[model samples]
Target chain A: MHRRLALATAATLCGALALTACGSSGSGSDAAGPAAGPVKLTFWSWTPNMDKVAAIWNAAHPDIQVSVQKQASGDDLVTKTITAAKAGNAPDLLQAEYQALPTLVSNDVLADIAKQTAGTKDRFAAGVWQQVTLGSDAVYAVPEDTAPLALYYRQDLFQQYGLKVPTTWAEFADAARQLKQKDPAKALTTFSANDSGLFAGLAQQAGAKWWTSSGETWKVGIDDAAGKKVADFWGGLVKEGAIDNQPMYTPAWSKALNDGSQIAWVSAVWAPGVFTSSAPDTKGKWAIAPLPQWNAGESVTGSWGGSTTGVTTGAAKAGHADAAAQFATWLNTDPEAVAALVKEAGIYPAATAAQSGGALAAAPEFFANQPDFYTQAAAIAKNTAPAAWGPNVNVAYSTFKDAFGKAAQEKGDFSAALTAMQQATVADLKKNGFKTEG
Target chain B: MSTTLTDRRRTAPAPGTTPGDAVAPPRRTAWIPTLVLLLGAVYCLIPILWVVMASTKSSGELFTTFTFAPGSGLLDNLAELSHYRDGVYWQWMANSALYAGAGALLSAALSGVTGYALAKYRFRGRTAIFNILLAGVLMPPITLAVPQYLLMAQAGLADSYWSVLLPSIVSPYGIYLARIYAAAAIPDEVVEAARVDGAKEFRLFRSVALPMMVPGLVTVFLFQFVAIWNNFLLPYIMLGDDHKFPVTVGLYSLLQQGANAPALYTLVITGALLSVIPLILLFVGLQRFWRIDLLSGAVKS
Candidate 1:
C-alpha cells in the first residue's frame, strides 16, 4: 500500500509538470518563416459552396493550389480576417459579406477587384455591383450572391384560416391579428432576436440607408424618418398580438414552427427551401409571396446578407491572386459551375446570366412545386435599390437590434428607442473615426 | 464485486440522514437525494434530447418547426452530411479521435513519470518546483494559446496536426492530479523493498508501483482524453486548414455559413449531435474508473 501511494503521488506530480511545460511550449514560437513553395493561396470563406469550389479548383489547377478554410459565422469571419491581417499573414482571397465590404474597403484590406476585372460593373447584376461600390472610383469586392427578402408562409395554415395572401402591410397585420385572435398560441410573424441582420434588411425595404457618404462626410440615417417608420411598424406588430415574443436564437421559435404555432416568417431568397427542408413534413404545404410593403411603389425587396470575394493585400503569394479572381468569376458566372454551386450550397448566383437562365426557372420542386419562385426572386432583385451600408454598419445594426427588441418585446417607448439607437450610432461612427454629420 | 459495492454504496443513507449519521439535516423528506438526482438528470438530458431530435430534422424543418419536435430527416441528414465534401465530417471525426486518443495517451504517460518523480524524490527546490507546476493551473488557456500559436508559426508548424497535438500532450492539470494520486497511492517502503531486491529505480516503478497506480492512471487518461476532445478555442486559433480541423471547428464553420444560407443550421445541429456520440459512449463505458476524490485523498494521506 505504501509503494502504491508513492507511485501514484509521483505520477500526479509528473502530469502537473508536463502540463505546465506544454502550456509554455505553445507560447514560445513567434518568428515568421521565410516564404516559399507553390503560389500558396489561403482563401477564407463562410460559404458551403467554397468547399466544392476548392475541390473543383484543386482538381483543375494543381499548380495553383487553393486551400479553402471555413469560418465560424459572419462576425467570426470578420474578426478572424482582421486578426489574420494584424498578424501579417492573411489569406490570399477572402469572401466577406457585402455589408462588411465598406469596412474592409476603408481599411485597405481588400485589393481593387475593379482594377483586375475590367467592365466588372457591366458583367454582374447592376444592383449587386452598385452595392459593393463605395463612391464613383473605389470598388472593394465583387458580389457573388444576392439575398432578396420575401414572405414565407404555411399555405395550409392560410387556407385553414380562410385568409387571402396579404399584399399590403396593413392587410398582413390584420391577417396576423386574426390568426392570433383565432389561436392565441400562434403568432402571425416572428423575427429572431439573435440576428441583427434582419434589421438591416428591414431598414433597406423602408428606403433608409444606414450611411450615405457625401464625399468625405458620413450622413448617419439609422434614426431617419424612414428607419423610425420601419421600427414603429415592427414594434407595433410585437405590441399587438401579431408577432411572437420569442427571438430567433431561442428554441421556442423552432418549437413554434414544428408545433404549428408560428404561421409565417419574413425570409430571404434562401429561406424557403431552408425552412421546409429543415421540416420536410411541411413540404407541399409551404408557399412564397412578395413581402408586404408599407406602401405601393415602396419596394418590399431588401438584401439580408450575401458574400463578396476580395483579394487580400497582405497575401504571402500574389502568384495565385489572378487565378483566384478567375476562379471566383467562374464560380459566380460560368453556367455549369454556377448551377453546380446552386445545387450544392443553395446560394443564388449574383450574375444576371445565372439568374436569368433555366436553372432558376426550373423552380425547386421543394416549395410545393412553386413554378414562379425565380420570377418572384427576380422581381425582388429588380425592385431593390442601390442601398448603402456604412463602414460602421455592424456596430449600428447590433445597437439597433437591441433597441428594437426592447421596443418590440419589452413594450418600451418607440421614440425613446429611436433616440437611443441614434445616440449609439453617432457614438460608434465617431469612435471608428468617421466624420458624422450633426 | 466492485460493481455491487458501488450499487450498495449508492443506496446507502446520506451522510446526514440517519439518526446515527455524523451530520444532521433539515429532515423535511427522504425524497431530496432522488429529487436532486432527477433534476441533474433533467439538466443533462435536455440538451442531449434536443440533439436527438435535431439530428432527425432536415435543413428546412430545423428552423420552421419547433426545436424539440422530431422530424423524418435523420437518415437524410446523415446521408447528406456523409456526402458533404466526400464525407469530410468523418475525416474530422477521425482527426479528432487521433488527436484526442494519441494526445491523451502521451499526456498520461508523461504525467505518470513526471508526477511520480515530483512526489517521491527528495530533490533541490522541491517545494518551488511543485509550486511552479501548480502555478500553471492558474494561467488562463488563452495566454498560453496565443503565444503557442505564434511559436508554431515561427516553427512553420501552425495549421498542422502537430501544432495542435504536441502542445496538448503536456497537461499541467494532468500532472497535478497524477502527483497527488501518486503520493497517496504509492508507498515509499515498496521502493526500498524493490531496491533491497536488487531492482533499478525505473524497474521498481515499472513493475511494483505502476500495477498499484493503474486505477489512478486510468482516471488521468480519461480526464486528459475528455479535455482534449472538448477543446475548441485551442484548435480554432491554431488550425487554418479545414482538412486538419476537428469536429468543433467544422461545425462552427457550418453554423456561420448558415447565417446567410440558413440551410446549414441543420447540418450544424446534426454535426454537433454526431460529435457528442463518441465522448458520451466513452464516458458511459469508463465511468467506473473515475476517481474524483483523488485531490482530497492526497490531503487525507
Candidate 2:
C-alpha cells in the first residue's frame, strides 16, 4: 500500500514535469508562405465557397498563384492570425467578420488595404465601409458581404389584423399594441437578450457611434441618449407585453414564427434564407420591409452580420501585399465572384455594382415573389449609420447580455444594460493599454 | 454478488429460512441497481439514437418534423456527403482512423516499455519520475496545444502528420497507468528468475513481462485511443490543411457554415453518424482480449 501511494505520488509529479520539459521542435522553421516561382499566397478563410473565388483568381493570373485553405474553425482562424501576426509569419490574406475588424486592427494584424489599393472604397456601401476604416484612408479590410436589417413579417396575419407596414418606430409601437389587442395571444415581434449583434445594429440605427478613436485615445458610448431612446421604446413595449420575449433564430422562435404567435422578425438579411430552409411551411406568407425608425420622415438602417477579406501584415514580409490586395478586391468586386458568393453561400453581396445589376437583386422565390428584398436591403446598406465595434466588444457584449437578461426578468430599464456595457468596455480598454477618454 | 451478499445478511436472522430463500426472488432491491445502470446506458445512447434518426432527414424535414422520427433521406444524404468536394468526408474519417489507431498503438507500446522499466527496475528518482507523469495527466490538453504547435512550427513539422502524431504518442496518463498496471500484473520474482536464467533485460521484458501485461496495455491503448480520437483542440491548432484534418475538425467547419445555411446541417449530422462506427467496431473487436482481473489476482498472490 505504501508502494502504491509512492507510485501514485510519483506519477502526478511526472505528469507535471512532462508538460514543462516538452518543446515544439518546429519553431525553427518559418511558415513564411513564400514561394520560389509563381508568387504563391496563402488565403485562410472559414467562408464557404471562397475556394471557387480563389480558383477564379488563380486561373486568371498565371504569374500569381492563390491557394485558399479553410481554417479548422473561425475562432481558430482568428487565434492563428493573431499568433502568426505576433510571430511575423501571418498568412497573406484572411477572413475577418466586420464586427471583429476593430480587434484585428487594434492588434496591428491587418495591412491598410486603402493605402495598398489606390481607390475603389466608394464601390462598397458606406456603413460596411465604416467597419474596415479607422480614419480616412486607413481602411484595413475590404467589404465582402453585408447583412442589412430588414423586417420580415407574417403578411397573412398583418392583413388579418388590418395592419399596414409601419414606416416609423412610433407607428411600429402602435401596430404592436393594436395587433396584440386584436388577438390577445399574438405578439407583433420578439427580442433576443443574448443577441448583442442585433442590439448593436439597432443602436447603430439610432445614430449611436459606439466607438470613437482619436490619436491613440478612444471613447465608448453604447448607452448614449439616442440609443437609450430606442431602448426605452422597446422596453416600454416589453413591459406592456406587446412583443414576445424570446431569443431569435432559436427553435422556440422558429416554432413561434411558424405558429403565428410572433408575427414578425426584424433580423439580418440572412433570416429569409434561414426561414425558408428551416420552415418551408411558411413559404408564401412572409414578406420583407425596411426597419422602422424613430423619425417618421427619415429612413435609416443598420447592419448585423458581414465579413471582409484583408491583406495581412505578413503579406509585406512575404512581398505579396499587391497580389493579396488584388485578390481581395477582385473577390469582392468582380461580378462572377460576387454572383458565386450569393448563389453558393447565400451571402447578401455588399458591393454596389453586384447588388445593382447582378442576379442577386432578382426576387427570391422563398419570399413569395417579393421583389423588394434585395433592393430594399441594398438601399438600407447604403443608409446604415456608421458604428464602430470595439476590440473589447466580446467582453462588452457579455456584460450587456447578462445585464439585459436580468433587466428582462425584473422589468427594469434596458438602457442600464448599455451603461454596464460602457463601463466594461472602458475598463477593458484601460487594461489592454489603450487610453480611454470615457 | 453484492446484492446477494446484502440479501443473505438481511435474511440470515429469519428462523427456519430454507435453501429456497436463496433461489426465490433473489433480491427485491436488485432491480434498483439494474434500473440505475439501464438509465445510465440510455442516457449515453440517446445522442447516438438522435443522430441516427437525424441522419435520415432531408433539409426540408429537419426542423419541421418531430426530431426523433426517422425520415427517408438517409441514402440521399450519404450520396450527397460522398459527393461533397469529391467525398472529403471519407478522407476525414480515414485521417481520424489513422491518427487515433496509430497514435494509440504507438503510445501503448512506448507506455509498456517505460512502464516495465519503471515498475521492475529499482532506479533512482523512480517515484519522482512517476509523480511527474501523474501531474501530466492533470494538465489540460488546451494548455499544452499552443506550445506544442509552436514547437511543431519551429521544427518545420506544423501542418504535417508528425506534429499531431508525435505529441499524441507521449501520453503521461497512459504511461502512469501502465506503470501501476505492470507493477500489479508482473511479479518481481519472475523478472529475477528470468535474469538469473541468462536472459537479457530486453529479452525478458519483451518475451515475459510483455505477455503478462497484455490486458493492462489494452486498457492503456484504449484510453489513449479515445482521448486522441475525440481531441479537437490539438489538431485544430496544429494542422491547417483541411485535407489533413480529422473528422471532428472537418465536421466542425461544416457545422459552422451550416449554422448560417441550415441546408448543410444534414451533411454534418450524417458525417457525425458515420464517424462513430469505427470506434464502436474497435471496441467490439477488442472485447475478447480483455482480462483486466488478472492484475487483481496477481497482486494478491
Best by lDDT: 2
User: For all the models shown, what interface RMSD does each have?
Assistant: 5.7, 5.2
- For candidate 2 chain A, which ten residues in a row score worst on lDDT? A11-20
TM-score of each: 0.83, 0.90
DockQ of 2: 0.35
The lDDT values for all models are 0.73, 0.77
True-structure lDDT of candidate 1:
0.73
| Residue-wise C-alpha lDDT for candidate 1, range A323-373, written one tens digit per residue | 667666666666777777677777887876777555676676667468777
- Model 1 iRMS: 5.7
Candidate 1 chain A: 10-residue stretch with minimal lDDT: A25-34
- Which whole-number lDDT from 0 to 100 does residue B94 have in model 1? 93
lDDT per residue for candidate 2 within B169-254, as digits (tens), equals 88887787788878887888998899899887668888999999898889888878888889998888777778899999888888
Model 2 regions more than 4 Å off: A1-27, A31-35, A72-76, A409-411, B1-29, B258-263, B291-301
lDDT (C-alpha) at residue A6 in model 1: 68
The CA lDDT at A123 in model 2 is 83
| Chain A vs native chain A, TM-score per candidate | 0.87, 0.91
